[model samples]
Target: MESDKMIKPTVSYHLFLYREELARRNARQLRLSRTKIDITEELISRTVKNIKTCSMDDLKAVNRELVFKRKLRNRVSKLRKEAKLAKQ
Candidate 1:
């Protein structure tokens, strides 16, 4: 009867330890999940900012090229008129 009583207490103690360990594991997992979400949000913000900056740079480059081409076309037309007058 004494041994049976001791067995119950021992089993309860082991169960308590198991519960504590599971709680710690769950807390650790929660922390890791939170960190992953934070990092992902930061990365997304940075990527969006980079894309906006790159798009602005691309627009500026295209505008500059268009202006340069227009000036080149005007110069070519003037030169062609001069050549025609010379031939006459």
Candidate 2:
């Protein structure tokens, strides 16, 4: 009887679970949306050309942008992991 009581989930408990699932899905979607840059071959070629032809200051700016994107990716990955663990 005690086990049965513990095993049965209430309406509020169901709602909480639904909310948690929604939050997880939202986090996953946010990560996808934020990182969805279409890096085609043309873009890569353009970047290579820019690197070869750009001034030192332009190269530095590009380096900074790359670093910023790296950090953002890391942060998003961390957040996604945290969200995954939280679901458990």
Candidate 3:
């Protein structure tokens, strides 16, 4: 009877710990999901703004504009890569 009493409290303690740990993990996942959603929204907003601003002129001009944007994006990506490497 004494061992049974001791085992019951031990099991209850472990169950409580397990519940707490699961709750913590769930909260962390929720925060990460929210962050990803926020980033996605920001990217969409920026893309929409760029599309709205792009002029639809002559084909040559449009091509030139696209090339320029591509070059600029490549440069930015290179810079980001360099910065990340430096941090490492």
Candidate 4:
């Protein structure tokens, strides 16, 4: 009777941790998926077409912003890769 009580509580505690970790992993994946849509090849080409046809200053501003943003993204990606290598 005593071992049964101890084992049941321990198992329940581990199950609780497992559920918490699964929830966290799912939330992180959801957030990353949203980021993927904003920076795609299709979005780039569409932007270029808009810049050609668009006279609005705001649209042109967005095009220039994406240009510099891509450069920054490249540097950040390289740094992240270097950090990952250092960790291993």
TM-score of each: 0.38, 0.48, 0.35, 0.35
lDDT winner: 2
TM-score for candidate 2, please give it: 0.48
Which candidate leads the pack in TM-score? 2
Counting clashing residue pairs in each candidate, in order, gives 0, 0, 0, 0
Local distance difference test, candidate 2: 0.55
Candidate 1 lDDT over 37-77, as tens digits, reads: 33434344445566656676655654565565555556656
Question: lDDT of each structure?
Answer: 0.51, 0.55, 0.50, 0.54
lDDT of 2 at 4: 77
Candidate 2, position 26, lDDT: 55
Q: Model 1: runs farther than 4 Å from truth?
A: 1-54
Ranking by lDDT: 2, 4, 1, 3
Model 4 CA deviation exceeding 4 Å by range: 1-41
lDDT of 4 by residue, 1-88 (tens): 9886665434335455445655784543323332332333335555667666766774766666677557656755766677689799
How does model 1 score by TM-score?
Answer: 0.38
Candidate 2 residue pairs in clash (backbone atoms < 3 Å): none
User: Is candidate 2 or 3 superior in TM-score?
Assistant: 2
User: Per-residue CA lDDT of candidate 2, range 1-88, in tens?
Assistant: 9897688554455455545656783545443423332122223335668686778876666566666666656776777788789899
Least well predicted 10-residue stretch by lDDT in candidate 1: 28-37
